[model samples]
Target: MGIDACTSRPFRGSEAVARGEVSWGRLAGPAFRPLLTDVYVGSSAEVDTATWVRAVALWGRGAGVVAGPLAARAWEAECPWEERELIMPTSRRETSDEIDVRRDRLLPDEVCFRYGVAVTSPARTAFDLARRGPLVEAVAAVDAVAFRCGLTSAHLLAVAAAHPGARGSVQVRRVVALMDPRAESLMETRLRLVFILRGVPAPVPQYEVRVRDGGLRWLDLAWPRVPAGRRKLGLEYDGPEHRTITGQNRDLLRDADLDDQEWEILHIGAVQVFDERRADQLAARVMRRLNPDP
Candidate 1:
């Protein structure tokens, strides 16, 4: 028999078989992909993070709130969807390589719903992510989520105050101090953090420079103030998208405009922000420019 026509969402294998939608053999075939033990989605189903969240919710019979990175992604944060995380109130024997199940109870206000699955609220999601990973990465994750969810430093701090004894609360507080909602991308946040961690004065995120034609040009990061004869410094994170010919041409035009306005622009790439040695070098270069020899 052909696979079930309802391939848009996940369904139980037994139910598909019993409903005469798909045979047991067909269900076991490549036509369907297993999510949990019995949970399956059609092989062609466009399974995204939300799909996985819903599948796990079904597997657990809706017993837990989806938290951590998965929850951040569900809230539109630019987080990696490597694993699905579920916070359960009680322990369970079943476990899957695809899911990270944590046993913890959540306050009523901490839980919310997204894409029809229970998830931690933005504040709680920020709280969890801001406290879990490397300091720079944690701050970047929180920045993306905060910007997407319209959260401010105060919103994150309020959550931290409520969970004073929470693991990584100190990290969360530090993240709050560094998080900038104006950050437009993950790499941008990392670039900013590199300078901050290297002891270079923190450059403003998304700094705007007024152009010749009464238009405003925003730099990825900028220091508006500088000593006499030293142009204002602007730093840009040039991701892969900026490597294309058209993108390069556009950047040239923009850079020319900024140059005419006496703004010095430095373009940074992934290596400059990710590679530790290179990151230090990049920061050192910026320091020289910002603090030229007197």
Candidate 2:
């Protein structure tokens, strides 16, 4: 029964510890720190470059790398993301050889880096996707790049210029022209998109809405919908950006004004529109308010 000094049991993860690891990242638990949510073992260290490539192969585009959505989540960014799921970009001539999945291949204008942990280079991600990404998603990504990641429209434009003959070059230039780096945040941009998608007429962003005797209130999404019967509906996107006491008070006053004027108002958010369970319900509400059944 002498202790075998040379053959100490290698730390094959103990059963209890394995269970402990599994319990991290629960909805409300202190230990709950999500690694890959459904199919990844938690490794405190960033996924080494080799493992990152393997994960890309097995999980395709949904897998969260250390620098993927995890980075945004850890930083607590203001954009709408619930399950650490961030959309990954792929190359025009994407290849599954170097990395397991076909990452949106970088166009000639797209910039990239080797952070050792895989990530879209800020310049590359913002510029390359200026035209291709969903309007809302692109705005958020640009926010992440410019505000959170410290890139600018000029930087993105430079990247686009780098690849004169690349796919989407012209469109990227156009989008850059339209993008406003000074936009308050990604959520604000999505608010603008909500109006576009819901067929609410385009808004004058940062427009001031005022009553004759009142001060100005900046609108998130303002649209003039329908002129029949002296009625109209104005919409706004109330994302988490303005969930504070001050913001709540401001909106309350705005609501009071619209109520007095008989101007219908609509409020939308990522959860109200993007949540699978309630998207239809929200759509119905919008339709009912905008086009009532007589």
Candidate 3:
């Protein structure tokens, strides 16, 4: 059979073979790729996070609720694709390198269906994600979910309160305190956490200032504390979008305009923001700018 005869959506390999949709021999061929044990998708199917989440749901016979990072992505949060996770009420011996199965009971309020896939509610997803990662990563995850789902600190706190005895409740609360829906990108959140983690006061996110032309410009992060003969400090995280010639030229103009308005803008790239040593150095530089010697 040709590849076109295979099911476009994910299907059980055994079922497909039994139904004569595709022979066992064909499934073993390159036309189909296994997502989970016995769960197969046509090789040409676009397999993104959503596809994997759906596959896991199918593998469980629709008995599991998608949770953790996968749940966060399903909610449109800016989360990096990580291991597929599922929460089941009972223990199962099935094991797969690709999926992390958590055997736990979820409260009724904690589960919801999205696009026909059962997933943890936004609050629960944020609560779960924030509980057990590096503090910076936890904050970023919560910020993304909060920003995308319009979740407030109260919503996160409520979930924390509900799960008081949960493993990472303390960390979850800490993440809630740092959560800011104003964060526009993951790197921006990580950059902000770098400073705050180093005992720097949290800078205002998406800070707005009026330029010489009477138009407003927003800084990714800013400290409006003005010292004598010194301009306010502004920080920006430059991602791949800023590497193009046009983007670089536009940044130069923007920086010049902001400079004219007594704002000292510092642009940081992935290397400076992601590398541990470099991030520490960048934070130190900002501290000096924020507190100049007499």
Worst 10 residues of 3 by lDDT: 1-10
Best by TM-score: 1
How close is each model in CA RMSD to the real structure?
2.0, 10.6, 2.2
Cα lDDT of model 1 by residue, 54-125, tens digit: 887877778888888888888888873356788988877457776788886577888999989899999999
The residue ranges of model 2 lying beyond 4 angstroms of the native Cα positions read 1-125, 128-135, 143-162, 167-183, 198-200, 239-250, 280-294
At residue 3, what lDDT does model 2 achieve? 15
lDDT, residue 92, candidate 2: 39
Task: Tell me the lDDT of model 3 at 39.
Answer: 92
How good is model 1 by TM-score?
0.93
**Which order, best to worst by lDDT?**
1, 3, 2
Local distance difference test scores for all models = 0.85, 0.50, 0.84
Sorted by TM-score (best first), the order is 1, 3, 2
Tell me model 1's lDDT, rounded to 2 decimals. 0.85
In model 1, state the lDDT of residue 128.
86
Better of 1 and 2 by TM-score: 1
Writing each residue's lDDT as its tens digit, candidate 2 over 12-38 gives 123324556332233124322223323
The C-alpha TM-scores of every prediction are: 0.93, 0.45, 0.92
Q: Which lDDT tens digits does candidate 3 get at residues 51-133? A: 87788898877888999998998998887548688898788745768678888668899999886789999999988888867
lDDT of 2 at 7: 20
